[model samples]
Each structure stands twice: as C-alpha cells, then as structure tokens.
Target: MTLKAYRTHFYKELEAFYPQEEYETFFKVLAQEYLKLAAYEIPLNFQLELDEAQRNLFDKALSRLQQNEPLQYIVASTEFYGFPFQLSPAVLIPRPETEELVDWIYTDFKNTSCTILDIGTGSGAIAVSLAKLLPEAKVTAIDVSEDALKIAEANASSNAVNVQFIKQDILDCQALDRSYDVIVSNPPYVRDLEKVEIKANVLNYEPHLALFVEDQNALIFYKKIAELAIQALQPNGILYFEINQYLSVETVGLLKNIGFSQVELRDDFAGKPRMIKAQH
Candidate 1:
C-alpha cells in the first residue's frame, strides 16, 4: 500500500485509542524506524509503497498500539538525557522528570570527583547519565530484578559510560556497604490507589514492580533509601529522590524526620512537586 494511504488507515485504526497528535507521532516514529523515512520525507514521498515485510511490521505495531502498548516498547528504544536507550518490558521507560533529577545532580557536583549510588536504578538512566555527565564521578546502580540489571548494564555499556550494576533489593537491605558523596533514587512512589489515574498504555505495559507501592505505605521505598543514605552517605552528602506529587509534603517530612537536612522539594517542568533533595 502507498505510505499515504496506509497513514490514513493507521490514523483511523488508532484514533479512538490515542489522541490525534499522539498517533501522528507514532506514525512518524514508526516510519523512521521501519521505512528509514524522515518526517519531512514522509510528506514528500506520500506515494511511496511499503514492501510486504514493512507492511507486516507496521501492522504488528498497529495491533500492539491498539492493545495499549507503549510506542517506545513497540520500537524497543527511547531517548533519555540526549542519549539513546534500549527498552523492554523488564524495565520502566525513563521519564523526562528523571532527567531533571540527573541535571540537578550534575549541576551540583559537576566539578567534584564524587562517589554516587543510584538505588532502584531500573534502566540505569540516572546512573548512566550522571557517569556520562560527570566522568570523574564513580557511579553504582542497583536493582532487584536480574532482567532489569541486565538491561541497565547494557545501557551503561551502550552509552559509553562506566557504571557498576548490582542486584540488590533496597527494601531488604539494612545498610549500604560503603559511603557515597551523592545518593539518588527514583523509586516506586506510585500508590496502589493512584492506578486509576494511570493511562492504559503505562498500566498495561510498564513493569509494575518499578511503578507502584501499597497505599498504606506509599513512601516505603523512600523511607528505606533515606535511612540507608543517612548511614551510607559521607558527611554532608546529598540524597535525591523523584517523588510523587501528591505526597510531596509527606516526603519532605519523612526525610527531615529521618534526620536529613537542607531538605528541598522541587517541581518538574510541569510545576508538579516531583523531585526532592536532602543532605545528611
């Protein structure tokens, strides 16, 4: 079928499942990946015909999209912090707010050769980006899932950055083996009740272990990580977290109550309380 005709069919198939602008983006991304057609070129070559294999691929992607699969997972890749990362159902797709967390750390410790630990580092987005941005810093990332650790390790290698990948469950650990100058985590802060607010694409396709917590203890990961950071951080070391917006005050209070100083909560680009940094 001609690319233009297929594009129309694609929109019609997915129009109910996704926004017009979003499905439009999906087509552009799939076109580039599957057809080697740039967005600009897609318009100019509307008459171009897709081969059997290409049509098959697009059909499969359409089916997946209709099933609420994320386009990144469909493409098996995403961009984070200006670097390309391979994606899978094993790990959570990196979000832009996490990039803000990385930038905050880089801006603070850009010149220092510090030791950093990233707890619950699903795809190693924060750890790898920090290692790349602050080359002199030593970065270590830990996750409970072997599959996630494998993907995170590959991301570190592919990004050309050195990050130690360790398999550890932060909730089960009592103490860290060593101290770090900076410790950060974008842990599972979404509570069970908040599932209603999540989109079908995320709720259906993303890894649940990396995205949720019990409503009774939504700050479970943050509390444990903060406790570990208190004893595992060097004197005056900083701790960072990507927190849930609805629980910002509670998060900051927990950090302070746990003895963290200079506790500051910051909003993401959308002005939602999504990040926090504290000092030991």
Candidate 2:
C-alpha cells in the first residue's frame, strides 16, 4: 500500500463524518499522530500499517471520531500558547478564547511581580502559561476534580512552570488565605438551553461539568468566583474571565454587582464578547 492509497481510503472513511476540507486536515493530523505513535520510523511518504493490531487501533480511533469526539480527545493532548499539554476526559480541552484570556493577563503582568490565581484550572493551561511568562509572579490554580488536577500537574511540569495546583471546588473555597493581584477563570458558563449551539465534537468529548451551567443560573461559577474574589484579591485587584458571548452584559453586570470597578468586555478573534476584566 502506498501513502496515496492510504490517504485516499482514510479520506473516504472520514467523509461520512466530516466535510472534504475538514477531512483533509483530519486525515493528515491522524496520520501524523499515527506516525508519532510508531516512533516516526514510518515516514510520511509510506503507507500506514494495515496489520491487525495497527488496524484495530486505527479503527477504534476512527469509530470515536465518527461519534463526533474531538480529535484532541482522541489524541489525549493539545497545544496551547506554544506549549503541549496532556489532556483527558477528566478535563475540558483548552480553547482559543482562553488563550486570549492568558495573553491579556500576560501582557498586563508579564514584567510585574503580581500574584495570580486561576480558578477552575482545567489542564492548568492558564496558570502554567502565566507562570512561564511571569516567572516572578506566584501562580496558584484550583480545581474541584482530583483527576483533572493530576493532568494539570503533569501539564505544569511539561511546560516547566511552577504552579500550585489545589484540589478544591471553587464553590467550596472558604479557607484560602492568600490574596492575588490578578485572578482569572474560564469557568463553565454554557446554559443548558444553549446546547443546540454547541458542536458535536465538544458535546461528545468534552467534560460537561466543565462546560455547562443550569439554565436558570448560567452565571453560577462567575458569580461564585466573583464573590470569592472579593475576599481573595488584594485591594484594587483585577478579575478576568472567558465569558459566554451571549452573556456579555450579564457577566459585566455580575462584576459590577460584586463591586469590581473598571469592568471591560472584549471580543475574541471571532468578534464574540469572549472575555471580561474588572478591578476590585
């Protein structure tokens, strides 16, 4: 079998689940991952293995993809902010909007010694990125799931950044003693009613606990984190969030209601109101 033949068959198989343009990229990425799994001994020009064992692995992965699982989940890793992070079902994959949030914080505090805290620190993407960018700042990250924290710790190590990973729910975070100069979160904000708008890849592969909120209480985590921020931040501290685009006004309102001044909402690359920042 030649590489061309393998790619042709792969694209045909994926066409049932994806469009041609997406099939092209997905096929290439899957081929790359497969080559890496084989220790790169299999060159890109060669065909993928059709042996029983390798075929089984490919079939399993393709089956999951057909179910609309994210390719990152299938690979169990993703790249964010030029750093590779290990991912699992225990944590939601990091998103580009959250990358903007990190970049915003990094630009504001990269040269400062301000302390930072990241709530709901799934995959430790934000916390680790901050620590890498601002080595002088102390970074602390908190999450409710120990499994997620384990992946986050590994990601912190992989990024060669020191971040304190705490396994405690933000909703139950009461005994914390430290105050941060800047606090950030990309908490669950998807309202139950907005399920139809979500992509099948996200809905199928990503952890729901990290993606959704009650329909009537879509701002649950934001409200809780803002209330906690009142006591967790130093005077005149800043709070940042990757917010749902539909709830930009509500998110800003929540920050104002919490007494955070200088509230600002910014759009992401897609021009959706995706991030909010405010001062306490």
lDDT of each: 0.93, 0.85
TM-scores for candidates 1 onward, in order? 0.97, 0.92
Task: Find the 10 residues in a row with the least total lDDT in model 1.
Answer: 37-46
**Residue runs of model 2 more than 4 Å from their true location after superposition:** 37-44, 47-52
Across 81-143, the per-residue lDDT of candidate 1 in tens digits comes to 998898899999999999999999999999889999999988888999999999999999999
For candidate 2, the per-residue lDDT at 36 reads 54
Per TM-score, the best of the predicted structures is 1
Pairs in clash, predicted candidate 2: none
Model 2 TM-score (2 dp): 0.92
